[model samples]
Structures are given as structure tokens and as C-alpha cells.
Target: MKRIFDISMSLIALVVFCLPLLVVAVLVKLTSKGPALYWSDRIGKNNEIFRMPKFRTMRIDTPAVATHLLGDPDQFLTPIGHFLRKSSLDEIPQLWSILKGDMSIVGPRPALFNQDDLVKLRTEVGVHALTPGLTGWAQINGRDELPIPVKVDFDAYYLQNRSFLLDLKIILMTVYNVVRSKGVSH
Candidate 1:
């Protein structure tokens, strides 16, 4: 049921956001020297690695590390990168990942491939068994502000309490948070 819902919603969202996606792509290309999409290596379900596409918000030369880990991350932003990150527009391309089965609409956000501490903690707590998501409990709770262990705890909570209704609630809250531009730091 969850897989079916993910596919259906992802397809509808892709269709509905088609124009915005194109516009973002054009803007990204015009404002940056690299490809409009950045294919990041992310840790997915069961600790497997998968490529996740996001609208490129940083320059081509930016170090391949978590934005939070970057010293003065703003220095790497392309002209429109701040706007893209703040508006969460950079995430639109992940709909394709959801459609492709690498991500769900709601689950623990995927960690960067090099985030060994995060991966180990989540694995220890058995949170890695679930598919990664575009948005999740930790996302709505504190997003970039949450510490890694706390984020893993939230993921574990979701694993224990996951239900259709909980997923729906998470989705709705994600939209609200995105609209309000809450919890994002980069």
C-alpha cells in the first residue's frame, strides 16, 4: 500500500510541478557552471548506496560534504542557490527518486554516503531497514538543526509507529513546513 501511494503521489506531483521543475532547471543552469541537477551518493534502505538527484544549489567546486559541515557554506552558493534552498525548490527533482523507488515521500531523510557516524547510529537502532524519504519526522521536527543521534531517534520512532495515517500526517506537516520555510538552515 505504501509503495502504491508513493508511486501514485510521485507521478501526480511530477505532472503538477512540471512547469516549475523546468523553470528551476533553467534558472540553475543560468546561475551555475555545473549541470542543473546534482547527483549525490546517498545511503538508502538497509544502508545501500543510491544516487539521488537534487537541483544543484552549490557550485561545481564545492567540497562534496554535508552543507552544514562546510565552513561558510554560503561561499559556495551559486547566484540563486540561497533562494532554491530556502524555498525548498531544490528538492523537486527527488520526486523522480521517489518514482524510481529509491525514496519514499515520507521516511528518514537519506544520509550522505560519507556520513559514517549517522549511518552507524541509524543502523544500530535498526532505522536503516526503512527506505529513505524526501521528508520525514526528523525533517519536520528540526531538519538541519537536529543532531545526528536525535535524527536517528526520530527515524526509529517512525519505524515503530509507521502507519498510513502517520505517513499522511507527516506529508501534510512537510508541506506546511516547506511553505513556512521552517527548519531549513541551508
Candidate 2:
């Protein structure tokens, strides 16, 4: 049932946002030196590694680390990068991940491949059994602001309480957070 919901919703999203996605792609290309889509090595379900695409919000020269870990993340931003991040437009390409079965519409957001501590903690708590997502409980709750352990705790909670209705609620809350630009530090 969850898989069906993810596929259906992701397909609809890809169709409805098609033109806007094109526009964003062009914007990213024009504002940055790298490809419009950035393929990141992200940790997925059961600790599997997968290539996840996001609209490139940072420059090609930017270090391959979490944005929060960068000493001066703003310095690496392409001209429109900050705007893309703030608006959450950079995440549009992740619909493809959902379509490809590497991600769900609602689950724990994937961790960067090098985030060992996060992976370990989530694994210890059995939160890594579920697939990663474009938006999740941690995202709507605090997003970039939450600490790793707390994020894993939220993931565990979602794993335990997952349901169609919970996913719907998370999706709606994600919409609200994205619209308000709340809780996103980067």
C-alpha cells in the first residue's frame, strides 16, 4: 500500500511540476558551473548506498560534506543557491528517486554517505530498515536544526507509527514547513 501511494503521488507530482522543474533546472544551470542536478551518495534503506539527485544548490568547488559541516556554506552557494535552498525548490529532482524506488515520499530523510555517526545511531535504533524519503517527520519537526540523535529518534518514531494517515499528515506538515520556510537553517 505504501509503495503504491509513493509511486502514484510521485508520478502525479512529476507531471504537475514538470514545467516548474524545467525552469528550476535552467536556473540552476545558469547560476552554477556544474550540472543542474547533483547526484549525491546517500545512505538508503538498510544502510544501502544510492545515488540521489537534488538540484545543485552549491558550486562544483564546494566540499562534499554536509552543508552544516561547511565552515562557510554561504561562500559555496551559486548565485541562486540560497534562494533554491530557502524555497526547497532544490528538492524537486528527488521525485525521480521516489519513482526509481530509492526513496519514499515520507520516511527518514537520507543521510550523506559519510555521516557515519548518524548511520550508526540510526542502525542501532533499527531506524535504517525503512527507506529514505524526500520529506519526513524530522523534516517537518525541525529539519536542519535537529541534532543527529534527535533526528534518528524521530525516524524511529516514524518507523514505529508509520501508516497511510501518518504519511498524509507528514506530507501536509511538510507542505506547511516549506511554505513558511520554517526550521530550515540552511
TM-score of each: 0.99, 0.98
Quantify how close model 2 is to the true structure by its C-alpha RMSD in Å. Answer: 0.7
After TM-score superposition, what is the CA distance of residue 86 in candidate 2 from its true location, in Å?
0.9
101-140 per-residue lDDT for model 2 (tens digits) = 9999999999999999999999999999999999999999
Q: Each candidate: what lDDT? A: 0.95, 0.93
Tally clashing residue pairs in candidate 2: 0
Residue ranges of candidate 2 with Cα displaced over 4 Å: none
Candidate 1 local accuracy as lDDT?
A: 0.95
In order of listing, the candidates' clash counts read: 0, 0
